[model samples]
Target: MAASGDGISKSDQLDSSPSSPSPASDCAFSSSQSSYMSNAPDPRPDIPSPLENGSMKHHVNGDSGVNGINGQMKATKVGSRSWVGIYESFLMKNASQIASVESTLQHLTYLFPAKFKDAEIASEVVYSALGILGLYHDTILARALSSCPSSAKYQPSLHTRYTRHFTTRNSAYRTIAYMLVVIQKTELLNEIMSRRHGGQRGQHTAILGIESIKATCRLALLRISGTRTLVTPPIPERDIDPNVLDQDGPITHAEAAEEDGDYWMMPRTGQKMPQLKGETDVTRFLMKKVLLPDDVAPSPKLIRPLTTADGRIKEILYILRPLVYALLALLAARLRASKRFKGHYEKVVINWMPWVVGFALEYVCRDGIIDSLSAEGGIRAALTKITGLEKRELEKRSNSMWWWTLRGQFYDSITKPILDKMIKKAENIPLLNLVGLYITDYQYLAETYHFSTSTL
Candidate 1:
């Protein structure tokens, strides 16, 4: 009555055997036909009727009455077998589809761009893919996050490996740079530092990270001033190249003085060559006429002696300048933190605060210390008067206001543009003090040892 695992029914066998009788020929069959039917044995057990057996079977055996029944049973089994095969095939196909979805999700998670004009749309695609993947392979994503590096160096690796795989129009460098800061990946930070020593690209990444670091420092300073809601992030360890030196060699000095020197008569031979008198005279003439009168000349006036009063003022200015700058910085940072400002405008304010404070301090120092002292006169007055004149001359010589102005100009011309590029590049990396950390480590080691020139 029921089919087995092999999918064949007992009734199916009986229906196909030959020499079986037809249902309508029981009473009127010819003698020869009757004899043939009687001589053949029934393949199936005899039953009272279809109701008794609880199933029906039609004998085939060239029996005319059962022709349609045999055909139908045969067709049904074949069709059933085909349907089972199709179902199994569908299952296997979907298994492969699941794997593909998982692979796509992993790639998307690692390489998702921070900013996109169609970010919501892209995110939907990513989410859908990830959701499908997670349904089958959640462990894969967990493992990736677990294995992620903590240092800054990994940020570039991500930029090169993951970000490039995504949209070509966006910056992979800035995206990973932001992630490195946001995620606070120390391993990635170290990797970034190491790369910085490699080539121009690495150096560029380092410089981008440095801007973020300075902003974080400013924010911290602001918080201390009670004007900012955000606290200053930790300072990163600085990487100081031990080989950097203050010393100048003979060749360096010569090159620096080259504009005034007689190039035509200068050594045109080996390391040391004969010096012509005519060339020496010409150089002397140029030095007096063209170079000496210029700021480029090496003169005593260019090298101001550091006096006790000057040092004291320097200390005061340094302290007061940062204090005032911190206040402004905090105010700007608070605004940013409050979400009242964002993008390029927020950055401009943050960068401008320090320069503004420096300018204000210069104005105060010049007018209060130098100008005020010179106005009071006597023998104690004469010395005070002389010093005040010298101080004012030095102040004028330095063009302190001009220096601040130039600094502001530099911020606008160079720093801001570079910062804009960096911000776009570094998406939302963790706040790791990349530059500070490198510099600190270098300074620490340098202080721990005293080295000879050969050792260096």
Candidate 2:
């Protein structure tokens, strides 16, 4: 029993010992378990390690930090520019105004009918004044744009586009100025004369005389103010063989005497033409003693632009048409004023047909509709192929003719009628109603007389 008690006490003391070999083994096992948990790859790979997360964040922050530094450098450089550099951008260039101010005002006339309505004299004065101001404006703006370095290369093309041939260039201005004379003969003239003279007229042709002088002065100004002539396209100095001139140089004095001023002897309307400046002597001198096969060559070879210059023959109607209308109007007025004539005949005949004829003549003459009647084709088609005009360019010109529905007589005859019906329908539509109702002023304008009852 004593031996068993001693063994039990030894086991109890060993269990209660502070530094036992069992405890040390247990400590080693616990440390190994903790190391295994830390070093082993986790089954949940979805949860990233704190070290991996920190590495990814550092990489992203590094990229963002570089970008921010670059942007700040760029901003500092731009912000350093001086105010003088900013001002020089706009200040160095010439200030300019628009060239189409007159056309714009005319188009806008429908917006203010009351100002231009029955007051013919007032309207004429206003339109003429604005037209003059616009001419000066165009002149100044042209001076400005042409002086610019960027636009200098395109100056010639710009001039060609904006300027017309010599004959037709001033057609509109000339017409307006001349109308200033006859415009007084219409309602405005009659009203003024009647108010002062009280129908007891004693041959008051002095007003006509004054207007004629004024018209002459206005024409002189137009001649002085605008470009007088265009530079005629460079003509091939000689188309004939070199030795061909060795054949003949006949005296053209007789023929020249008979010819008025058709200096270039171009294809013309046979009407006496004034000597326009900058013409080339293309008389080929093929009228030699011994004629070559080339001399018989009758190609319709003329300057490209001059081919259409003859179209100015019809444009002369600009000057003649208005004068004719004015004279006819004066006759109609006289007939109305006659004690023998009275009611219906006067109203229908006096101002009615004159306006229609004049308006039609204006478009027909100016827009080359008359020339289209005898357009150059077949034999002349080869000759008419203007330089620099390609087949595609010509096709573009042909296609653009479809846009003529918006201009000239086509507008009066075709476009306006269709637009009238469409306008009413458009006015009924919700969003589109604005286009037809208040936006366009010409939709309801009278076709016969321009600006309602105004003569011009």
State the displacement of the C-alpha of residue 319, model 1, in Å, after optimal TM-score superposition: 5.1
The regions of model 2 sitting more than 4 angstroms off are 1-130, 153-315, 339-456
lDDT of 1 by residue, 81-157 (tens): 55543443342224334445556765664333334453323544565445433422322211221222211111111
Q: Model 2 over residues 359-382: C-alpha lDDT tens digits?
A: 566555543322432366643454
**Superposition error at 188 for model 1 (Å):** 20
lDDT of 2 at 61: 54
Cα misplacement distance, residue 433 of candidate 1 (Å): 32
Model 1 misplacement above 4 A: 1-315, 340-354, 366-369, 378-410, 413-456
Q: How far in Å is the alpha carbon of 75 misplaced in model 1?
A: 99
Best by TM-score: 2
